[model samples]
Target: MPLSSLPAPTSSRRVLITGAASGLGLALARGLAERGDRVLATDVARARPDSVPAGVDYLPLDVRLDADWTSALAHVRDSWGGVDVLVNNAGVATGGRIDVATMDEWHRIVDINLLGVVRGCRTFTPLLKEQGRGHIVNVASLAGLVHAPGMASYNAVKAGVVAVSETLDHELAPHGIAVSVVCPAFFRTNLGASFAGADGDMEAAGKRLLERSRRSADEVAAIVISGIDARRDIILTDWDGRIAWRVKRFARPIYRLAMRRAGARIASTSHTIE
Candidate 1:
């Protein structure tokens, strides 16, 4: 359905977005608030000045911690009466080939990127169910659908998120709850800089990819919020993301070949001494 035809979000729609201090989350918060929805913005770091829209309630939250989710949800319930939408937008990337990546890196990525969404869903679903109708937007990535070199851990977690969100869509649909999983190809954001990594090469590669990507965070945020309003099941933020998913679905052999070529290029570059 077209976004224009979906249910209009009004002052009665209460929204809670994680990672709202910056990037797509912040953009969505501002957009929703401008549309007159009461927004509760939460993030791990301190709230950014001028990042949140007027009337938005900003809360400090660490998605990795269950206590943080509980407190944030309570604050939202107390202030807004009930949450109409929950955007699980908080995530972190870990860079490096699987063999070279440390156990700590793998655990950290899974803890935040995958389990964070799980925790949010587990905590907020009851609140949403009580309200009888709501939306859950889980931000996955294009990498979640397709393999990418040097992003094994991050990809694994995001893929898990996609799977979990899809399952929840089925499970929650019967309860009048909607779930949308966002798969953005790439956007101009601080994700690369903020990604936890010890390897310089992996970090450089991540930076290079982020710089080359065409999408902006605002564009991604618009797509996400529109999808939520439309009650879409899968939200692809850009043409690249849509095309990538298509290739993965209908042209698996070709996609595998492309991945192999990219992997070969990385291997060749790694062999050359600096």
Candidate 2:
């Protein structure tokens, strides 16, 4: 369906977004607020912006905590009557080979990146069902579709996200709740800064990668909003991501060869342990 033909934002278009303090989450909140939707933005940090647009509200939330999700959803239910959208945009990244990475690091990454999405979906799916009509947008990544060395855990978690979201889309479609998984290539965000590391070199490498493929957060936000508007099941944020998906699907040998070449580069890095 065309974006123009999608459901228009009315007072009833209530949206709740996680990780709204910065990056794509903030951009999405601002865009949706500008479009006249009542937006409830939440982040784990206490120092959220003091003011948002008149229709936008801010809440404190830690996606890993069940209590936080419950409180956030209850607040939305009471204030907006029902939530029309839920954006599970909160995530963190960890880079290293699975074998070399510390178990603690692996747990932390999975807690925030994979299980966070799982928790969000588990908590909000019922709320969306209660509303009878709603959209769930889960932000995965281009990495979810293909393996990248040094990002073994990250890629695994994102792959799980894609699987869970696709399943949800099938399960929720009959109830008028549309689930869309967004696969975005690198974007200009503070995600690199948020990378947890026990050493300096790993952190530096993460920063370099973040800077390399940076795109404006607003651009990604626009794609997400447009996807929601059009009720698209899969939203690819960049041309590279689209191309990668096509190659992976129709040109398996070529895709595998490309992955092998990319993996060699990543493996050669002293910073990345195989």
| TM-score of each candidate structure, all chains considered together | 0.92, 0.90
Clashing pairs in 2: none
Tens-place lDDT per residue, model 1, 1-274, is 2223334565458889998888888888877777677888898865555667778888988999989988988898787788888999998766776666779888888888899999999999998898888999999998889877867888899999999999999999988999999988877888886766655577787888788877778767777878887889988888877888899899999989988987877776552111
Query: What's the count of clashing pairs in each model shown?
Result: 0, 0
How many backbone collisions does model 2 have?
0
Worst lDDT run of 10 residues, candidate 1, spans: 1-10
lDDT of 1 at 156: 90
Model 2 error, position 139 (Å)? 0.8
Tell me the TM-score of model 2: 0.90
TM-score of 1: 0.92
Task: Quote the lDDT for 140 in model 2.
Answer: 90
lDDT of 2 by residue, 86-151 (tens): 999999877775556778877887898788898988888898887788899998998888766667
Name the lDDT value of residue 5 in candidate 1. Answer: 32
Candidate 2 residue-wise lDDT at 29 = 86
Output the number of the lDDT-best candidate.
1
